[model samples]
Target: MAPRFTVRYFVRAADAAEAKARALDIALEQTVEIPRDVVPKGYVEDEILGRLETLEQAPDGRPGFLATISYSEDDVGGDFLQFLNIVFGNSSIKPGLKVEDIGLSPGILSLCKGPRHGITGLRARAGIGDIPLLMSAIKPVGLSTAALARLAHDFALGGMHYVKDDHGLVDQRTAPFSERLKACVEAVGEANAKSGGRTSFVPNITGPADAILERAKEAEAAGAGAVMIAPALAGYDVARMLAADPDFSLPIVAHPAFSGANVVSPDCGFSHRAFYGVLHRLMGADAVVFPNFGGRFGFTREECRSIAEACAVEMGGPKAGVPAPGGGVNFARVPEMRAVYGKDVMYLVGGALLQEPNLIDGCRRLAEAVYA
Candidate 1:
């Protein structure tokens, strides 16, 4: 009798009968993980067990069936990880199964509450009204704190809305996190004084589990515009927990590092949209960064669009998140990207801008192109 959320999985099978059996197996496997013959009776069989709501052939011409299995909220117990276990759990280890989409129930939303500063909030933070946002990263991990901070300053002066630390930049000795953060904050503060622009300096907070939340708090205290984290690398729940924490209030920029294996397979792991879009939103990422189409990562235009749409789709109460596509984004592709994502996206470009002799001028021109 409890409320239930649905998970749509693409199951490979030769016939409808086999597909139905596989879906039943998932219902049992994801929930009880026991023999069907002895799955207990009464409450376990009724309320706790997952219900197979629908099963049909994949309309996309794929050789599989889309099976929707709904599970009771009682199975989740208001715990996020438990909820995820019910969503994927042991099911992920088995081949021939792919998580295509997950329905967000009231239980899930009540548990997570999604992003604190979603699309509109990020746009407001950038001091822009109805325009696409610009973001870039300070890269080459071994740079000194002063050098990295200088890149932060120049990026701000060039009209970037948010300048972030490269995901690979960690608490290395050359540019200690504390030292780099302080330098970037100060540098951007100096840039704001001259440019009269509200460019925010974002720092990467991805690190060991015990330290990331501490780093996020430090960044917030240090006047960082936002904090970036590779949720897949730092642990997905880490990002969600920070967003749920009342004491930590900085907007989260999610990076899709080390996530290819979960998505590259044709019939396993997850779809590009499900992994990069829905997962990030659930983890409360204001901006979900991913490998863009026409980029070196080999994501197709359709896959990129699916992610963009998922970021801003109407998902009950949670606010729409912004999709940030990077990985080889350049000036030449701006117009084409704009055509696909419209005015709500944040273009993450660095090498293309840094290649220009005048970093500020290059950024300005990119902004002009975005506006046009």
Candidate 2:
């Protein structure tokens, strides 16, 4: 057997015969993309082609077969994009072929360059130790830099470890990236001075491709503690490229702005854990934001919990990513969230905190609730 990594996909099929046909289709569709009659008999057929290793019925009442197919690392060539392509490229376009798990081979893991500042690193930077962390966003867009800065200040004073820009708050005319980044960083600094907390402003760096690196460097120079990117908006590789850059020191936090479609489907798209947890961790995200269960988003308790588990699973090399679940989260849900996610997660509360009569006090109350 050639050196290869496994990819587990759920193929909708009624019986072994149908399952065998679907699995073979996947093996060829994902690799050669040509007719079986034409697969030349040699290295391409034996080594380069995707090999279906195992096929078993999905557990319990699930209506599919779990097909484990192995693809050679040679096909990847140490390229992250190609790895993604090989994993789900054409297969994603086909219905009833959902990606369940991605098994990284030794060669792939060596190329991973996983989270530079994953969970523990994030805590160290925020001067926090073990205990769930708190994060809030400065939002509603269209606001002036000063107004946004004030919000960052209040959130920091309220003891949020991270105060990030709303994903939509990019370089708008009212709040240009440079102006907003400088003001927010300074405001958070002042708040930290008064509160004796190490809260850091996290500016969103998702924007035009040519300008993202410039913004990241600017954020670092402006003293922002971390930076966020809607990888689904910018590009899947954006986070990975930023995380891999040696000069970029700020921790990378990934936002799920346009990623819902990839996991919301019943029998298509990637699994919640595969997309939000493994993908973000593999992309070097210190933390990943997703819609929490009980939130306005329709994620279930089991789906959310699986994401949390994947974030901290014993990967053994790459440091664990932190799962930050938000969307309609409020004070009433703190205990429930804690029970579901434990201490390894980051509690992200946004609009609810901003709607409070006193933003600072609201944040303080949330921090208190988390600690309790």
What local lDDT score does residue 37 receive in model 1, on the 0 to 100 scale? Answer: 91
**Pairs with steric clashes in candidate 2:** none
**Regions of model 1 farther than 4 Å from truth:** none
Task: Give the winner by lDDT.
Answer: 1
Residue pairs whose backbone atoms clash in candidate 1: none
For candidate 2, write residues 138-224 as lDDT tens digits. 987999999999999999999999999999898899998889999999999999999889998999996778998878888998899
lDDT of 1: 0.90
Going through the candidates in the order shown, the clash numbers are 0, 0
Query: TM-score of every model?
Result: 0.98, 0.98
List candidate 2 segments past 4 Å from native: none
With candidate 2 superimposed using the best TM-score fit, by how many Å does residue 347's alpha carbon deviate from the native? 0.6
Worst 10-residue lDDT window for candidate 2 reads: 104-113
Query: How much lDDT does candidate 2 score?
Result: 0.89
Angstrom error of the Cα, residue 62, model 1: value is 0.5
